[model samples]
Target: MTTIELDTTKLRADRLFQRKRLVGFAIPAVILAYLTYIFFAFDLPGLAGRANMDNAVTLVSDSWSHKVHVTRDNRSGEISYAVEGERKGRYPEGARPAWVTGDEVITIDLGGDHIVRYLPENRTEIEIPNFPLIEVRAEGRSLVTNLPDDLPGWISASNRRIGITTPEGRITLTGARTEVFNYFPGWELFWFTLDSPYHGQSLSKILFGERVDPARPNISGAMSDWWNNAMWRHKDVAWAIGETILMAFLGTMGAAIIALPLGFLAAKRFSPIMLLRAATRRLFDFVRGVDALIWTVVLARAFGPGPLTGALAILITDTGTFGKIFSEALENVDQKQIEGVSSTGAKPLQRYRFGVIPQLVPVLLAQILYFLESNTRSATIIGAITGGGIGLMLTQAIQTQKDWEEVAYYIVLIIAMVMFMDWLSGWLRGKLIGRKD
Candidate 1:
């Protein structure tokens, strides 16, 4: 009865709530309807068609694909596939060639009624005579010499399994050192394999035979090649990396030399003179505020390209960073030591040399090592801007769109180099900072 005189305001609020819910539902429904119309209206098929067409054109025009390569796939065991020309035998065009037509294909008989045939078309097929399924030879660093009569062609030999064939099986050699693989036409085994002897052979010779491999999956030979050449050959990559490291080293070292003197001038504990401290602090701020890339461009424009430009850029950028860091390091030093040094009538430079530097050097070196790692990558960027070092090579490779092989090479090289630097820097830090027992 009390509520019989319904509060009109509460009823109005309830109606408003219902209206809000309806509006929310209606808004989403309208959005869904619009989306549905767009999905149906837009020509998604045309977009997909255009993308496929572009890929086809690019693949057709690419010259590298024409190059013959060793192919290893799950279906086809280690086999040779021609990049260009007509198909041979029952093998589909470019399916897998036995031996390149012109180039000598090696045929070997390992006995046990096994026939290794190097087909005229650059491929190897091995038949176990009575065996039902084909047997693909395992690629190994070691090779056997007995020639199989059923071999389709002359067999070339090596500790590295560059090329070998049989009637129904083929083995493409692969390992840590040797790299050969092929990716075009779906067979990736030949991409980084040793260059095929019949790489430039006629189209007919390209399709000697195809092998079958029920076991073993296709590995990225190109990536393997990069790993071996760039990373495994750590010693070789170290030199280029050293250049970058040297740049960072010199940059950090030179910056430290300059920062030490200036940082003292900037610190209040050391430089009680307000004007001197203010100027030094402002200078530090100004230098550190600018981006390293901007500094790189500016110095490159001013000095032209080379290690000198890269070193100078690193020097300029690091100087600001060093000044800021060294100042903080200086500020954090125990003040009691300064009073002790001063109480002994030690000169300002003497007091700083004894009191400030002992504490600051450890911090400075830690920061430097960190900066060395940081600047190693920066040096690559700086080198690209200045047209120096491997970075320059990488930039050119990327610009030309030359197969990503070279880019991969340089990237692996840089990563290896950075890892080495990290190891070396850590060792040095331990030696310098760790107390001798």
Candidate 2:
């Protein structure tokens, strides 16, 4: 009998090991099959062919660099020098870049032996090292160019327009105008536009040196110019950032206020009515499951697009989430404390106020502060759809396609804003919760 019992136990152990081995192999096989299905379903091979790597390279490079435009009107024979080809950044009359010379001919030396000469009669001359000179003459409604048929990929020419792209700069010739773009590192005119007297002055000079603008004090004038900088719109950006913070604050706090009662209704321990609890739970699920983006679109139509619309969208979505979280927290509260308060002959409301709320405070505060930080980032994206905050500025900059340096600036500001919010949330949490080491 002993031998038979030992044999049965050994056989059972062997079968368990065999089952484990089969599960391990089967799990990996199922995962591999799912991955194979996803690879074909996503059509990754076709996507590779559609990707344009050269455009991606250009976009990445542009985000870090700026370009100055030297454009000439072919019909009027008037030439203008502007940073990023913006009127706000146009160089004052009688002033020009050092690299450009000759008033009559207007010689532009794009470093590395690549030069462009704007001549009379709307004729343009391009000289590239180790290559034949390319000449283009813009006549009324047509462009005549001497570009060879075997020109490199960088040069595109036709009877109506001619485009030359080089490492140093780009030149485009057409029947209406001839433009030259000179690339340079760093954001130009970030603090002040070309018209400002403080444009070229150093910070130390502005702080300690003699007044540059005779009409105003040096430091005060510099501050005014920077704050009102037309090219960078510093004032506008500051206001937009404030709007985003406001949206997050109003939305998160309002949702907390509205969800607390709903949470009590949903929690079984607090509310004994099962039908009411189920209805409240379904309401929470309905709002929370709809996604913030969809809510933003629906609210935008009702509220007509502003920071208020964004705040309302966040409020509605977070209300459902807070209801669910608060209900869970309520369901897990210690009943011993409640019973002790009840033993003191305290009323129902008093017992809840003293016993239940104290236990819920830590969880409520922690969740509220966390969502405050998270909703700040969400507000930025929601603001884009609602036409309100820094996100709208970022969207406009990206849509312009030429102001990539500004896009980079907005991205940096957004990152800094998020980091600051995270720090603020953690500090508040520590202060309110009696820091947990």
- Which candidate's TM-score is highest? 2
- lDDT (Cα, tens digit) per residue for candidate 1, span 81-154: 43321122123334344433333554444345554445432234555554342323333434333444354443
Q: Per-prediction count of colliding residue pairs? A: 51, 0
- What lDDT does model 2 reach? 0.93
Query: Which residue pairs in candidate 2 have backbone atoms (N, alpha carbon, C) closer than 3 angstroms, thus clashing?
Result: none
Return the TM-score for each candidate structure. Answer: 0.51, 0.95
Residues 77-189, model 2: lDDT tens digits:
99999998999999999899999999789999999999999999999999999889988899898988887788788988888888889999999999999999999998899
**How big is the RMSD of model 2?**
1.9
